[model samples]
Target: MGEATDRSGGRDRFLDRLPWLLRWAVVGSACLLIVAAGVYVLARIAALLAPLTIALAATLFLAALLDPVANWLRRHRTPPALAALATLLLLLGLLVGAIVLVWRLTADQFSDLAKQLDQGLTRTRDFLTSALPISPGQLDEWTRRAVSGLRSSAPDPVTGAATVAEAAGALLLVLVLLFFLLKDGRPMWHWVLGRTSDRSRPMATHAGGAGWRTLGAYTRGTVMIAAIDAIGIGIALVILGVPLALPLAVITFLGGFVPIIGATVAGSVAVLVGLAAKGPTTALLVAAAVIAVQQLEGNLLEPLIMKRQVRLHPVVVLVAVTAGTLLGGIAGAFVSVPITAVVYNVLRTISEDRRAGAHAPTGAPADPPSRSGPGDATGVAGS
Candidate 1:
């Protein structure tokens, strides 16, 4: 009994010495448990929700791209639903046409492409044999092993079929979500703001508006940059008499959505095609052209467009891309930068507002409400 009393007294003394420690300890433990539970739930839902998440992301991107056009139609006396439907139909038609074109091109040239690939491999092997200290036998052995490994590592037929089905479902989901978002996005946003506390409602509105504008600007600017890249590279490949110029150009265009790595992969294919059809000299020239175009894009186009539009640092973009790829593969990489830009802008705006509020005189009148006007350009309007 005496020892139990002494221990209780000691515990009280410790608590007195660090009066807030127990309270903080309890709070921290609760937070940790909550976080752990959340993470577990997320992990469980990850695979099931992956396609849905991708669809949602695609919908957001499409919404950003088409919202302005829909709004324009609305201003011209078109009903919102009609405007959205029309936009969706037009985009769908274009997408179908593009797919048909690609399919036709591929079907017509597949045999030739196969031959070119064989010849390209042969040429590459020969060049490596002569330039490097590697023997032809060793190279052949390595190639055989790599091929065998790939075959062994590939998913089974059932798994592949399931993946295809999932992708199709996701695409359909995106289309459905995009139509609604384009038609009712503004109302939906206002509704969300309505749910916030009165003091925070303005901040939420400002943040959402700023984020939407950033996303829109990023999408538009990226499309422009990608189009320029495709046109320039396609023209270059055609002038160089490279085989599969159109296909390669289409690839570059699609790849431009993925930023640094995407362009490089597409350009490498162009160089390989050039080498396969026209030999080393032509291949070298094609490579040089690709490099030059990419450099111009990185230094001129991105700096002039994305820098002003997104205001993201290069390092931040790189890290975001890397993290996104690790988390969600190619789709993640494609959307990562734009999402980062939106989040960055939202956070910055909120931070600035908080600072302004803190610095304002206690009795001063609040700033006037922001208005939409001609000067209210998409991304820059919030600032």
Candidate 2:
């Protein structure tokens, strides 16, 4: 009994020796660990449901973009189902139109892309041999070895077929999910809000609204920003007399969806094309153009267009992208940042609402009633 008492006393003192602030810090750290663990588990579950997970996330963004159009049609006396279907068809039409347009414009040029790239490589090799200490034989030997290795290790046709089939299935699923979401998104959102306690309903509604707005703004702003990048780069390529400018522009537009890595890749392609087809001077010029355009995007376009709405620090964006890529591959990297931004926004809204509620002197509304305006956009909205 004496020994047990002494050991218990020692443990008590050990805990007691921690200062109040230190105890709080330890508790906070533990809470963070709990959150991290929860996130890890959720990510694993998401990976297991990769196709469904990706389809859902993609559909939310699509819903946010097209929900307003559906709503507008409904206001004009279109049935909910009709509005949703029409909006979905419009989206499909736009996608198909863009693909067809791009194909027609670049069909002949694409045939030359391989030949042009090869020619570019030959020129690059010559330039490298002249500019560097490397011998032509050494370069040729390296290229030959790389090609031999690639040819020796052919990819499995079955694996390729399976991957393509999986992608097609996911695309079909998105279309089905998107129509339902568009048709009944507002009711779904309201139903979710109703599920919460009366005490928490206002807060839930407000936070959900903020999250939806953040997503909508992020998607729309990203599209516009990416378009600007594609235009800027395409114009530069055209000015430099670079062939495949349209293809490069399309690549840039797509890359814009991927953030930092995407921009770097798009810029690198432009520079390489310029270097191969033109010369070192044109390549240098192309590089300068890329730098200027990217800088303008980072400084001018983002702030003005996004209006400080969907902001994330560069480090946060990088880390989110890395984590996402590790978990979900390309799709993970694409959705990670937006997810982070939305989560942050919703939590912030909740925190702010809670604080306002606590500080109210008397009977006061914790959250103001939502209005239907540009300021009132969400992931889903009613007419």
Candidate 3:
């Protein structure tokens, strides 16, 4: 025991010999490396269970959006299972109604989309012929090449069928998960807390509560932002006399769910349609409108609306989206921002808790480590 103590003292003395800055730098780097390695392992596991991973992420998103309604019903004396069922049915009804409305509004416009595209291409070709050095024949060759490349890249019918089957399975899984989460989310949270270590449980509980609130805020804020974008762009299209205005508007609304790239693609589609049906002037106007709306959303709407919960810089959001896209494609992009936001909120909560604990006086009771413990009654932390 004496020798062991001496050896321990010697090791500590050696560590103390290192410069404070260097020692801290090494410690921090090691922590970061360990975190990175853990993240990599988790990512690999998620990739191996791609469908289940996506389904689970999607279920969490939906639960965040719908849990409030379920809870509200429960507060009104409805049974938990009944409240969950009602909420689910109501959501399903709304979705079906929206789909039917969109189909009825845009079916005829969709039929004319092919003709509009041809006209737009012809006009674009004519303009290029008049202004640029490229000949019509050269343009035709480029178009043929693009078309052939698309054909080559197309999946075989069996592959397409398999992909569709996977998507259907994932969708079904999401619904099942969402239902259970809504019905039993509070009880489930307690079960988790019960299993957690005594020292860690309070911290976990606080961070989790923070994360759930952040997610719910993000979900609602995003929906509002998307609706504004869709409305703004849709009105612009109608005023510009774009032929598929309604269809384009619906597309914009749907795309808005995907963030930066989604809105851009929707806008580009609108511009292409405008150029096809209404000529360059209308297309240019459509482009201007899209740019304006996106700028407004980025500059004003998001900052004001998402600021309270998300609090991420634009660069951070962009980096997260790009990394997710590179790692897991479109689904990755869809889920990345929310995951980042939740993780960030949880981390911030943990840091704040740690700081408070460190500063508190001895023998003074610490603030209830889980101040949000009572809030768990509302079932906000759904899955």
Model 2, 1-383: lDDT tens per residue? Answer: 99999999999899899898998999999999999999999999999998899999989889878877987898789988999999999999999998898788778777777877788778889999999999999999998999999987866899879989999999999999999988877777777877889988777777887888888888888889999999999999999988778888989998888878889989999898889877778899999999999999989998888747598888999999999999889888899989999999889877887787887778766545442322233346443
lDDT against the true structure, each candidate: 0.79, 0.84, 0.84
Model 3, C-alpha of 216: deviation from truth (Å): 0.5
- Better structure of 1 and 2 per TM-score: 2
Model 1 misplaced stretches (Cα beyond 4 Å): 1-48, 307-309, 368-383
Which has the higher lDDT value, candidate number 1 or candidate number 2?
2
Candidates sorted by lDDT, descending order?
2, 3, 1
User: Could you tell me the TM-score of candidate 3?
Assistant: 0.91
Model 1 lDDT tens row, 253-290: 98888778789999998998888777788899999999
Error of 1 at 106 (Å): 4.9
Ranking by TM-score: 3, 2, 1
TM-score of each: 0.83, 0.89, 0.91
Total backbone collisions for each predicted model: 0, 1, 0
